[model samples]
Target: MDELAAFLRTRRARVLPETVGIPTDARRRVSGLRREEVAHLSGVSVDYYVRLEQGRARQPSAQVLDALARALGLDGVEREHLHRLAHRPAHAPRRASAARPRPELLRVLDLVADAPAFLIDHRMTVLAANRLADLLYGRRLQGLNIARHVFLSEEGRALFADWEACTLDTVGHLRLSAGHHPDDPELAALIGELAMRSDRFRRLWVRADVRTRTHGRKTYQHPSVGPLEVHQENFALPDATGTELVVQSAAPGTAAHDNLRLLASLGATPAPSAGGGCPAEGGDRGGALPEEVA
Candidate 1:
């Protein structure tokens, strides 16, 4: 199926008629607004809407796109996605060069000191991390790609207290990344690998969800600490395209905060049988940042 067509179909299928002020009737066979309905709401002819959905019409004017977005109730990210699908080039753009977080940015990440902070690129590859993050993520942080780890690894599956929610966020964020960088070969390879290896990833990938992991509260089931909850904030690095610094923090006086301190005191050595150790004291694990997962 054409990517644009499929995306439109999925979005259309999700908007219930009643929710959009169209009174529901059992006579309706389709789940969402009919093509003619959408075209009417979007101020276009039914044939034009049909052509768009059938992939016979690839281009739509900005006004029409905006109208469709309104009719579909698309959010900012989804609206941007609609525009991208409509405006994408005939040939995929060149893949971007390998990204690197600046040394200064790494220094800033380390300065977070009390919390877990790490830098990641558009693909969610761990580029650099602070001491606390090293202690927190341990081996999981090494050569880690967040989406790959969460979907393809056993440890990742067990890391989040709410793995299902995490999976949705991971998939949605990756979808947004694909929208932004459609031609990124590494990302395409990663997505293909996950699709082939993980049933869950494949299922979620087709949903066309789009989101960014900007800020949220996440609960981690740290093997050593039991249950740990943190507020994660993502800040896009200045002068860096497709790179962001993610910091995870716990509220003061909470058990999570105390657990964080305990983890720090334990240093690079993980609790017995808990699995994975942090970076060696005084420096990282004798390797460069942004280790690629094979």
Candidate 2:
């Protein structure tokens, strides 16, 4: 279910009405173009698109895959994701899922020069964060699971300006991911830990809130970089179950963008240093939403 839900959300977000030349008007009820519009543009049947989104159609042929890639206006990374989901096979018993990021993925994360990037499993742990990620958010993030830290730790609260909203939203997004990998023991243990540790998490988990995280703005109070506003992009890893390459970028020329680039250049960051320096520059803390709302 997690695999299916994730694929559907990814496919839907990758497409836009304007990408296919559809009029952007008040008639739009959903986030992106309608399923029928996507099918019509891609030369597939509406029923097929619906089936695919609903996760009922498991096997998409090569031709269908090509059509979806075109219709969704997927970039190189997204196109690869479409192919991966199309060919996903039902898992067999005794599956020993990975607790770390893939080696190839770590290489790719290092290759990213501009923004801090890393890979996170379903529970959103800091499995493989790069140097930049370590430098910026690394101080408070050390040895901490993202979900646990966000809801339980004071550092997490300080890092995020809108603490409650962001915590709730991220929890919801994690819920959606959990549904697809119910049998994955790592994910299960993560959920169990949260349930016991945080009362807020316990309530949210009981409500069964699930959300597909699409594009959005996230505010982080970086120790060195001060305040940074980044656009969060999650890309699925090829042949990896419940893994995503989470990349974050700031709008060009902003204070955060400039400071972050400088911080990255300095390099060789120490682990969780002291001092309350604000860098004398930052992003506006108002109106930044949580990781949910897709």
Candidate 3:
């Protein structure tokens, strides 16, 4: 299960004592370097590296992979690959270059400022999201990854009373996208990671139930507004790499709409992202969704 053992062995073999600026005081016994030396140089506990070398743990956390990558002196590409391997996500895979949305696609977003809007690939990467789009999703998490927030953030998790239900919906949406664009490297990587870490992810993925998410109603408790109901709209970008636009808004002329307007006037910016999850991207033209996720 620990497929990393072989790679880790090879890496240790290549790094000689003098090459990494480490002094080898003990008599070398093995063909490769000592485990302690590698552990020391890499800033990880010797036990952890040994566990990795022994293939004791099948899945390591992202932070652990980051530490190992630094210890191994891996470059950017190699480091990314290590993460890809460690997480073994279903949607992210090797890529030459990820597809960036075109300018006209952004122009269309500019027209939808009244609506809260954001774009997600099968990997749940927010390739492009407008200001208001960010407002709805960005506030709750330190970073944006619809999947990350769904699992990692407490407030984000609270949005859904039934965690399993939301998780299933998210993975199912991804599985459906994979059917449409099987070659997409990002999607492949995402699926792989979820499959490895979450049993629920794996179970839902196995069902092969494909569903395109579009219009729907959801209830959310906004930090500022208390609680609000929103109608969601999802549109798949035909030419884009299975990118879906998720938009949200409250009903017209209601009290919720007024509350959303009040919230928007607070000068909320798009989560300090390129688009910054602000209202300008599309915050409640009146009242919007629970949160934006870009």
What lDDT score is found at residue 202 in candidate 1? 98
Better of 1 and 2 by lDDT: 1
RMSD of each: 4.2, 11.4, 16.6
Which pairs in model 1 have colliding backbones? none
- lDDT of every model, 2 decimals: 0.78, 0.65, 0.61
Ranking by lDDT: 1, 2, 3
Candidate 1, residues 194-253: lDDT per residue as tens digits? 899899999999988888777999999988778889999988766425778888999999
Find the number of clashing residue pairs for candidate 3.
Answer: 38
In model 2, what lDDT does residue 108 have?
82
Clashes of each: 0, 2, 38
Error of 1 at 274 (Å): 9.5
lDDT of 2 at 247: 87
Screening candidate 2 with a backbone cut-off below 3 angstroms (N, C-alpha, C), the clashing residue pairs are: 1-180, 2-180
lDDT of 3 by residue, 201-234 (tens): 7776664444456788766666665565677888
For model 1, give the 10-residue run with minimal summed lDDT.
273-282
TM-scores, all candidates, are: 0.88, 0.58, 0.53
